[model samples]
Target: MEKVRLGIIGLGAEGGMYAGFLTDGKVNNMVLGAICDIDPLKRTMAVEKYPEIPFYEDYIQMMDSGEVDAIVTCVPHYLHPQMGIEALKRGVHALVEKPAGVYTKQVRELNEFASTKPELTFGIFFNQRTNSLYQTLKKLIEDGEIGAIRRTNWMITTWWRPQGYYDQSEWRATWGGEGGGVLVNQAPHQLDLMQWICGMPAKVYSKVKYGYQRDIAVEDEVTAMFEYENGATGVFVTCTHDVLGTDRFEILGDKGKIVVDGSRKLTIKRLARPESEMSSSMSMQDVMKIFMGHSGNDIYTEEVLEFNDAFGIQHISVMENFAANIIDGTPLIAPGSDGIRGVRLANAIHLSSWLGKEIEVPFDEELFLAELNKRIVAENKYPVNA
Candidate 1:
């Protein structure tokens, strides 16, 4: 009971990474207990690599065997909730991977189920939340360092994937497999961060392109506009085709503005007075003088912060935090309930694009599911190149 015996339920790229690290004892409070995968090759690989650990072709069997105190799902988007529910059903702590699930309905189901099992710790692998850069930004917003948020804009196009990437798996980019492309796969972290740092938008209107640059069936490019409940507006743009992609996130507030580029470098500009106050109080002459840089430097303060690459460390931190939460009474960095926010936002974006109109938060779940089913049916009827 001192250390958590963690079972990993997939041997894909992410699952493999967790297997390597958890087996290597990267997290002091967590040890690799068992590995499970439906793929025979992956099971063989797990056996060859970690012969001491049990290999189960069925996740249910692993959970039923009492070999693992907790389980982390590294499966596809759709299986996350299904497997997580199974883990929680057996009174095992569960840590789900990103995006929660392909849709909110399932994720909400998982959350509702987890709500009943309050004794068990349920968390999601929002590893980016462990990054100091985003942590600082979240605190700044919460602490009102930037007054109230006025606008947010993030353009993250660093997920450049070639055709071979999709060709490797039949379900790589199809609607029936990965759900959506950039938004569902490569951009979930940013989506989670956006809603986490700046509260979820009340409305979202998005223009999405399906397989624009890739040979996939789902969206590969997306541009979404958001309207907050407080009348603040925001924009989110992401795509997977930009080889020289840019990653810039900007949040403007009444008192200051925060900008992050490449997910590491942070820049903050603080104003002596709120923009609302300045707009109402400043005379034309005073504004002109300030605009001319005569007193702008004195009125504004700028700070630049840089963060080292903590990509691997972030994942380790999430795992350790999950274990710590189970071993002690520590709070989770990213609670399993919080995973639905990103999925809901992503659904809004997809629904907005599908309807070619602005969709409100907590939009019609039934309608979205119906529309998604149409695409899923089509994707299955006429499969993609992969």
Candidate 2:
């Protein structure tokens, strides 16, 4: 294809941001052919900025135009699956935003449909995977630098959202609207990163609290423990109500410990062992090089550069990948199936919280959906007058 024609659904914050990337020539081989949003105001706002492109209040209208080769679905959590399914059915590859869907069934359904339609490439925007530090960390773990991981802990209190933020969206905290809170929204990246680095957990136990910091009906705080199949243990704690912010991850293994603070600095203490004895008894000064190598600011810079390179000059990296996967048979950076795991983990956390017990892996999807439906009803009936 000479140029990948693009259509974007949902002209909200994320949609607008991605549109900026598109217009700025960050992604190559792509042209903004059309845009869609249910809210006419949002559509008008986006069109005001890019008046040359066609704007449609309904996504199907854009889809029917057959002018776009690929689609970017930045719609709300609940609509992701529906929009994606439709896009794939229409033979347009899709790049969807995070959490893919609000429920496990929706994710599975999307995955199943995408699997059958191998001609269409589906990707999720788990952009954290693009981070340089995370890439290095994943490389270290894969190369056995940590020497058989044992325990991992992440405390992410940094996502402190004010009450006004939640109030801004009707779907912010309601179960029927946005599903859960921190686990579903702010922490999906962390959960996805954890699984990406340490591997999927065999079991997950969690505790969640609603109304902890806001008037919302969903969780604002979540504490979860994960048991990995490799006998590794993990702890994840996140909240939106913290007075101060904290974003840190520490991984302990037989060889050494790796800690990453919010400052983006990584510290690795190589244990003195037989291998070290053969080399030398290195003090902190001797090991400083290893720490500094991993501590540099290259990762973040590299991530942005890569995204720009891939998307620049016609700005089609995301779209092109989807197109290539369908036409040229390229592998996706973050496939649709991979997106399901994070939501499943989030659901397990919610289930564990509701039952006050550790929930096992491969949770009963039906049971979770049923409980979520009940929560949705309660949330809808919540007294707005009170």
Candidate 3:
């Protein structure tokens, strides 16, 4: 009970990162308990590197080994839910990685199972949730700093991965393996942040390009439109092929607007009065001044917010919070159940693109899965040997 012994399932890129964090003592109140990987090379590497910690090829054995009080699922997109379920069944706290799963249906199953284990801490690696910029923006929206959102747009295409990146692993961009391309891998954080701040959209319409730049079968470029229940609308654009891409997210409300660039600089402009009222009551002369850029200080207040070097804090804070929640009842920053929101949004985007029409927020899971299976079957027909 002194410190949570954490076992990591998968020693790939993400698992290795978590292992490094734990072994480096970057996360407090937690220590590396065990490691698991089906790859013999990873198992050998882990054994040689961390001789004190037990390494297992079978994750189930690691969970049942009584060495770990909690576990983090750092495996593939599809395995996240199933591995989490297995950990929960063994009474171990579970923290999952992003997107929850390949689809909403599987993630729902995990969440439904986790609901019965209230005694255990269940969380997701929505590390971006710990970012101060998004946190402040969420608060501003919730506190009515920007009235109801009129429109929101985010163009986050800084996730530029070369073809070799996908070629490094067989499961990198395959439908049955990684599930999808940019949406599933690179843009989940933005998807989570969008809904976290502005709430989930009522409908989604998208235009997607499959393997447009890369040699993969899944989408590599996408531009999606969102319609909210409150008459608010949003646009989300992302691709992994941009070399010098943009990372700008803007949310415009009736009374104010918020703009974030590169996830670092944040600017908020609060109007002197709501745009609705201003449009109705402003004189022609005042409008002329505003149009001519003569109305300066009296129009609205501007504030810029920035947090330095929070990249490390994002992941470390999430890990520490997960441990603290298990230790002293601290609430999770990103609950495992909340993981489904991002998946749902991603699924909606993919479905909209596939169906060539607007898809409802709670889209048809059966239809989505059926379409997904078709692609998976085609992918498996000529599987890449990684």
Where does candidate 1 stray beyond 4 Å?
A: 381-386
Residue 382 in model 2: lDDT:
35
- Candidate 3 displacement at residue 113 in angstroms: 0.6
What does candidate 3's lDDT look like per residue over 200-239, in tens digits?
Answer: 9999999999999999899999999999999999999999
TM-score, candidate 2, is 0.86
The whole-model lDDT of each prediction reads 0.91, 0.78, 0.91
Q: What C-alpha lDDT, on a 0 to 100 scale, does residue 133 get in candidate 3?
A: 81
Error of 2 at 262 (Å): 1.6
Error of 1 at 200 (Å): 0.6
Separate clash counts for every candidate: 0, 10, 0
- TM-scores for all candidates: the values are 0.97, 0.86, 0.97
Maximum-TM-score candidate: 3
Better of 1 and 2 by lDDT: 1
**Model 2 residue 380 distance off true place after TM-score fit, in angstroms:** 2.8
Q: Which of 2 and 3 is ahead in lDDT?
A: 3
What does candidate 2's lDDT look like per residue over 282-384, in tens digits? 5665457546775333211121111122323222344555556655677865787899989988989998888788888888988888888888777664322
